[model samples]
Target: MLNLTLSTSSYFILGSYVHIGSLKYLYFMLTAMLYIVIFIVNISLIVVICMNRSLHEPMYLFLCSLFVNELYGSTGLFPFLLVQILSDIHTVSAPLCFLQIFCVYTYVNIEICNLAVMSYDRYLAIYCPLQYNTLMTFNKAVIFIAVIWFYSFVKFLITLSLNIRLTFCGNVINSVICHNYLVVKLACSDTRVNNIYGLFGTVLSILVPLLPIIFSYMEIFKVCFSGCKQTRQKAVSTCTPHLASLLNFSFGCCFEIIQSRFDMTSVPRLLRIILSLYFAIIQPLLNPIMFGLQMSKIRNTCKRVFCYKMLTRHKDTM
Candidate 1:
């Protein structure tokens, strides 16, 4: 049904704005508030982790990296979404759309990798305590972080390269977010190559990281079950935050991917939009809250920082 044509340039209509009819300003304000909260929470967590020397262990470093990735991912979407809400037109330039796709998807890839690494860190701490310091040293953490970012870039580049070269039949994406499959759907040319490569990238970017996390948790559970009550409680405390994050992100990803891949005309437009924006809005906002509130070390450091600032202000006023 899509007509293929040669055009100098094209813009995409974000058809996901249908639910935001008369409440544009209200929507913008609320989303802006959400974005601000996300920024504050993630930044606060990162600062808390970074400033505490005792908390510079592998788990905390990975948490900091996770927080940073959340900021990166949410930043890719929130500002743009706010602007789009204010404007009557819901179109984006070709280049900007592609850029968003790159930023957002790369954020996701890095998130999966970061969480995987965090699980591995916990595993090393619990199961291989003697080697935790030696194996997961500061330099090794940096290397893992580097690999997370680098692999995300390389995988997304390959997929985007395939997408950019395609001739598009139309410029409308029926979703709130930009991703490779949506763009490929608009292509006038055969997309078998893109689809194949996209699948490969998905497996590499998501499943590869997930495999390690699952294995680490399994090993962790085995050790916990065989240990004393204190050991079991410690393991539960350490894994609870990571598992919560994994579930939140996993659900968001599954919703978005399913929406993109299947016919969702039967679903309500508003609900679909919410589901699509879940990763951008909810996961980023939730990660810091989960980790900061639940992880005792980060929580105590945050309280100390807050108390210190408050006392400093009170003394100055007195």
Candidate 2:
């Protein structure tokens, strides 16, 4: 029988890292580069949205929030990953592990909620264009963003509090990062409350955001089908990137959930690692690229900003 009480100073061993001899350095470099790219691109878009008066609308405000969340999510994972990749000992202190859990859970919750709110914002812009200004004022947009962040933080705080009371039988985690589900599974103490709350939390997390996304898209599709070619074009142009982002993130999350909850022993280690990292790595990188390239307004603003800087620099040199 495993111990029912865990010491405060106890640490967790991450068991998922495969020894690749000198390849670990190569992996570290690639991860560092990826993090740098994610940071630069997300920051650039955030700056573009913030500095431009034209992007002061509710839609762009939502995008700014999205970009910020990408930075938050990636920072929570990448730096820790970089450290772990180089470390011969794959151990994390309990406090740090719990902290990572909080960060990651809150990030996921905020992301889903943010996307849900953005979907609703799009619905208003397309479905009620004339009334959008009244319906989703700048103040209202700020409130929505604040509420999404607050809700996610509070929700996970409760989950973390519940989890902290558990006594762990073991300290080995089977994945590359600190995961909530895997941690809960290690508890030697009774986890009925945790289990119940986790199930409830999972449902709420998914349905709360998912319902709005579905409703918003359904409404959007209705308008696209019934309305003229212009409206259809408008819907496609605005919604396509969002849809892509949402689906990509959702699929990544699904894979993560399935892998965590079920047996994946038959899956190849390399593929498992890639799929596990998909949501964290890809979404943060993809969002800025998708929105930056696909949205004409943002693309134009970026060009103008770059060109203006170059011209000013030339004048200074002369």
Candidate 3:
């Protein structure tokens, strides 16, 4: 379950063993289907945003970026895991393994910054609605997003460079995804500096985004609660999803980073498996649903996209 914790040794979940049983096979099929469904939904969102002028605002632009991020982020690991789980061979080469690590970590780091930036944008929109359009201009948003990608690239490069200095004499990783802590642990060299920097990095990455989210909601609550009945209802309806996502995603990060420093052997492997699935897979999958499902326009756009082809086919048959 927690076998993904190893770093330096090549491993295969032998078919004769726990890796390829009936239950595991079912899990693979389900995960693949889930990934396909979510990817399609995110793609539909991209198409809708691209074609619709009404969604040309900064908020919608941010949403489009999010759809792309999730699509790529999930794409990097999900399919590979699916194939590995199904195939007899579970081993990956050194270069491909490193690349997979880079892709998964980089996109996730970008997502962290994007969420923070989006939260800031929301703060301005709700807290300073009259000046939001001027403050979060189209050009400014474009710059912010560009910076996000640049920052992610630089961060991953630094982290990967540090890891590469150490030799992986053995080829072992315990999880489906090459988890960050496992990578650090697998390094044949000392990771003292890396460990210290990692601590600071974790705090900065999690807290920087979360602090603003906390304050943003504080202000939102103050403003929304102070309003009259109808206004309060309207504000609550709008803010609920953002607040829930902020809490859930922030909690996932905290648990992942903070607890990873402890001894893995002490914890039950089943528990660790639960945590990994929750933090890595489920949290990213939920973001679009949490934010986008509430929007009437997006749902309608999705319905039209799906039905358009079917309707045309039916008309031709008639």
Candidate 4:
């Protein structure tokens, strides 16, 4: 039996990396390009929302929070990925690994909470249009955003504290990134506390956001079915991108959870790697593109901003 206990100076070996030899360069370039695109698109949308007074509504404010999170989550993963792809060894220090775990867990929590809040905002807009302004004021929206972020951080800070107390029997993590569950599994010390809290945390994470999301959508559907054609169209247009994003993120997260908790040695290694990366990479890229194209207000504002920049550049050249 492996009896080594993890210490502050210890490092973890990431065991999922396949040595692709010269192909590592190709992988590195693609990852770098993907990271760059995710950064630019998410940042552009955030800038647009912040600069436009017309977009100061609750929906846009929620969206700005979402985009900022995309940047936060992507930054946590992509830089580490880029370095690992180019390096000969696949290891990360204990502190860095735990930091990644904190970033990732908090990002997921904030994302689901943000989406749930957005759904409630949509519900107010559609169901109680008369009172929407008063019900979801700018101040209220700001407070919701603040609470979602703050709550997620505190919740995961406790989780990290629990995991930090564990003395690991092994220092090898079977995934490309530092995963909390996988790290806990390596503990030589008693992890009953960690496991119990983990189960409670998971339930809270899903239920807190999920219950509101379900209620909001149920109310929305009720209004849509009985209301005018305009009401149905409004719901369809606004909810489609959100629904798509939610489903996409959910699927990615589900696959990751399943992969982490179960034995999946039968699955192809390449496919496993891709699926593991889906949530972090695809969701961030997808949210900006989907929201940018589907929302007319954002689209038109982007066009105006682009045209103004071009016109100013042309005058400077002249």
Candidate 5:
């Protein structure tokens, strides 16, 4: 029988009390709150997009998709982590391990495609405003969303099948959640096939999505200056948030692809934590904030959310 022993040390790879002292606990706690805030905000945005007729445009639709992606990203990583923070038994079953890693990857891949698709939507709106309606019709947007899900699911099945064939031999995982790279690293059997797939998957997830974003913005810039000054301001505000998000998201993919080679270095532990926080944690949190800041429509919708809730509460008293 596979020994399934669990421990506080085994699961919470970065423990609150681990030689780092109480600060680690505070670190994990604050980030956990960020995850919760992000989840709620994104879900709320999704509802607004669905209910508000004015938001039925291609851009808002794409924004809603991104909000959903952020929601999933936060959900996949944080709840298990929150439980680990508060509970004594912090380990996950090997099967559950597979599932957690799988979901994280699936959503992440979907988000990459969604960003690319969003960039295309922007390209159509800005690059060919007259044809934007015919170019990115609602049906095309729906099909694009479906393709994102399907593509990611296929990759998940491929990676999962290849990973399941390996032998764990022991039950210890160093990460708080089931991290895919870390898991494959622990496999006792040959994982060259899995590693190759990992490499390909990384390129698809990062570079494939990256190309259109760069190209789209390049075109956007060309056309922006050719129009009114108002167009230039709108272009900068809109593109800035998306650019920040794409860069931050790419940081994880870049790190993961090369992480195995770097773990042995004399790099300080603090730097690793900062990178993980910025790439994995803060990036998702930043998306909703970026949308709220740059997109006046989303910001107004968010404000209406609070006012709507308060009005309902007042009516209940009456």
Candidate 6:
């Protein structure tokens, strides 16, 4: 057993791996492909939204923000994860591990809050069409985006500070991803303070944005049912994408929370790896596909962007 306290720069063993001794290259290739696809899709959506003037609306702006957040979240994990997969030893430096914890959690918090903001945007568009423009102006959209990131960092910083104070006895992180809660468990000291703060932080993070999302969706549904067919169609077209993204992310978050908090040691190590990676790998890929398929404006814009790129490539070749 390695004594973590004696050396501040000790590494942590990432203890999640499946038996694939000969298939390491294959594993690396598949993982790299997924990460690359995630990057391309999210970046494409962001570019399509930003380059088109028609997509400058509040709803699209929020989508762009979500894409950016997804990119932020994915970059935090995939780069490090991809590198780790190629190496024989699965270890992360102490500083790098903590940094990953911050980046991953902050991404999650911002994601939920961004979804809440999108829900609110939908509520305003359907419930108060007249005020929607005034309420969700471009400047306000920017501010909301800023708040989503700022608030997430501020709240998580408290938990991270508490975590920094705890002294660790062990350095083995029993999962693929570096989670703050799991890191807290490695500490040798009394973790009551860390646990209390963690619980408070977790609840605060979830409830603050989650309640607003539920309320906004409730109001949106009420309006959709009572309003005209056109209104109903508009509501469905716009809100469905956000709702799908929310449900997908919510399930992933719930699974992660359950896995992290409870004892699931009997579960197969492969299953555990999948559970840990689902949110990090899946949600980022899903968001663009959901929006691209569901939102006509985005779909149309993407088509145009692709066509333009193809034309340019042909011209260059000729």
In terms of lDDT, which candidate is strongest? 4
Ranking by lDDT: 4, 2, 1, 6, 5, 3
User: lDDT tens string, model 1, 134-171?
Assistant: 98899899889988898889988877677677788788
TM-scores for all predictions: 0.94, 0.97, 0.84, 0.97, 0.84, 0.93
Pairs of residues at least 3 apart in sequence or in different chains that clash in candidate 6: none
> What are the runs in model 5 whose C-alpha is more than 4 Å off?
1-31, 87-90, 169-174, 255-260, 268-271, 311-318
lDDT of 3: 0.70
lDDT of 1 at 14: 83
TM-score of 5: 0.84
- Candidate 6 residue spans exceeding 4 A from truth: 1-9, 315-318
Model 2 lDDT tens row, 190-268 = 9999999999999999999999999999999999999999999999999999999999999999989888878898999
Model 4: lDDT to the true structure: 0.93
Please give the clash total of every predicted structure, in order: 0, 0, 13, 0, 0, 0
lDDT (Cα, tens digit) per residue for candidate 5, span 1-318: 333332112331322213444565786688677877887777877888898888888788778878887777777777766666565555666666777777888878887788898887788877887898999988888888888888898989788777766765455554445777877776677889999999998878877777988899889989887988887876787778888887778776566445434552465555543554354567677887787778888778778888999999999999
RMSD of every prediction: 3.2, 2.7, 4.9, 2.9, 4.2, 3.0
The TM-score of candidate 1 is: 0.94
lDDT of 3 by residue, 1-105 (tens): 222333454442211113446777787888888888779777878889889877787877877887888888888878877877776666665555666777877
Report the lDDT of model 6 for residue 176.
Answer: 83
Query: What is the per-residue lDDT of model 4 for residues 43-121, given as tens digits with 9 covering 90 to 100?
Result: 9999999999999998999999999999999999999999999988999988789889999999999999999999999
Candidate 1 yields a Cα-based lDDT of 0.85
C-alpha displacement of 309 in model 2, angstroms? 1.1
Lowest lDDT block of 10, candidate 5 = 8-17
Better of 2 and 5 by lDDT: 2
Candidate 4 ranges beyond 4 A from true positions: 1-9
| Per-candidate local distance difference test | 0.85, 0.91, 0.70, 0.93, 0.73, 0.84
